[model samples]
Target: MKLEKELIFPKGFTVRKVIELVTANERFASKIYFQTKSHQCNGKSMLGLMSFMLMTTIGESYIISVEGEDAEKVIQFWNKFVREIHENTTLSYWEEEGAQTVQEAMCQSISFWNSSVRSVAQSYLKPGKKEI
Candidate 1:
């Protein structure tokens, strides 16, 4: 599977936000990855994104490509993720650090992401199973 979209982060967005987005797609057990002219990172790993120096800024054109078994669902998640960021620029979902430690952040991240995309990924799920 494959798809490409030009996305813009509202403003003040960071690699951490990328981490969250990447984390969301990672849940699908798919072999997803992202790339640009200079960087390519595994969509399923936060470290993969950071280590590749994948970062976003307002108005920058990010040509993102996603592929894998659940690529379509992940792309939908990314679309929803970016739109929500624009709508809530003042309170970017990745914020609200209810997480105090690394482990806590990991747990909270999974929690935040699950809450964000359960609906979009649901179509790929078996009836009543709630996950993709």
Candidate 2:
């Protein structure tokens, strides 16, 4: 199967992202997908995709080749799957710091803020004995 058309993606979806997604997600790892293969598309099996080890560098592209009566349908499904992931936002690993360290954390944060303010003020100061 050879991809008759090109599938372009943005910089964020580079080879690193492919590897990260595949490794982190069991579903993706199990899917029959290939980054590179003799056919445009590889077998829709996770193991098959793992074997391809696609060079997902910037501007790298792959052809998805399929045949038979279901070729179009399979292509659509593949495209849709990729599209969904592309549009989704990655969840943040760190949310709020939480109240576990509120006391010491608050003090440290305040100190940091004070230091930042002092540093910024120093840049704008005239020859003076520091403005409080």
Candidate 3:
């Protein structure tokens, strides 16, 4: 599935809010499919979604690209819920905790690979030879 468009929620969007919205409407939640990250996939877990919130000072928008079997439904529910929340609730923006960037994650993976390769090289080489 692919997102027909990107949906940007206002600054106060949070995982808790998402859960609330989903829980409030059971039909929408039941349709979610677990897929790898993409325009169609949630790419985020329930815990992750619940943890995310907009930053207050900047009031940063949450960018969600909806793609999946139920993307349209989720988007429709979320859009309607956001409008309702804005009008009816006093929202508090919570900052999402820091998460490793793709680059940082890749570097960590490479570091592990390098170390493992060195270890294997050492096992095959003479004691005085370079590990690489």
Per-model root-mean-square deviation over C-alphas: 16.5, 14.0, 12.7
| C-alpha TM-score for every candidate | 0.53, 0.40, 0.42
Error of 3 at 23 (Å): 3.4
Badly placed stretches (over 4 Å) of model 3 are: 11-16, 22-44, 54-58, 91-132
lDDT of 3 at 33: 28
Which candidate ranks first by lDDT, i.e. highest?
A: 1
Each prediction's Cα lDDT score?
0.59, 0.46, 0.47
Stretches > 4 Å off in candidate 2: 1-3, 9-41, 89-132
Residue-wise C-alpha lDDT for candidate 3, range 18-73, written one tens digit per residue: 67854654454334422212322232445444434322222333355555577777
Best by TM-score: 1
Candidate 3's displacement at residue 97, Å, is 20
lDDT of 2 by residue, 17-63 (tens): 55644454333322233443343324544444544434443234665
Poorest lDDT segment (10 consecutive residues) of candidate 1 = 94-103
> In model 1, which regions exceed 4 Å deviation?
12-19, 51-54, 91-132
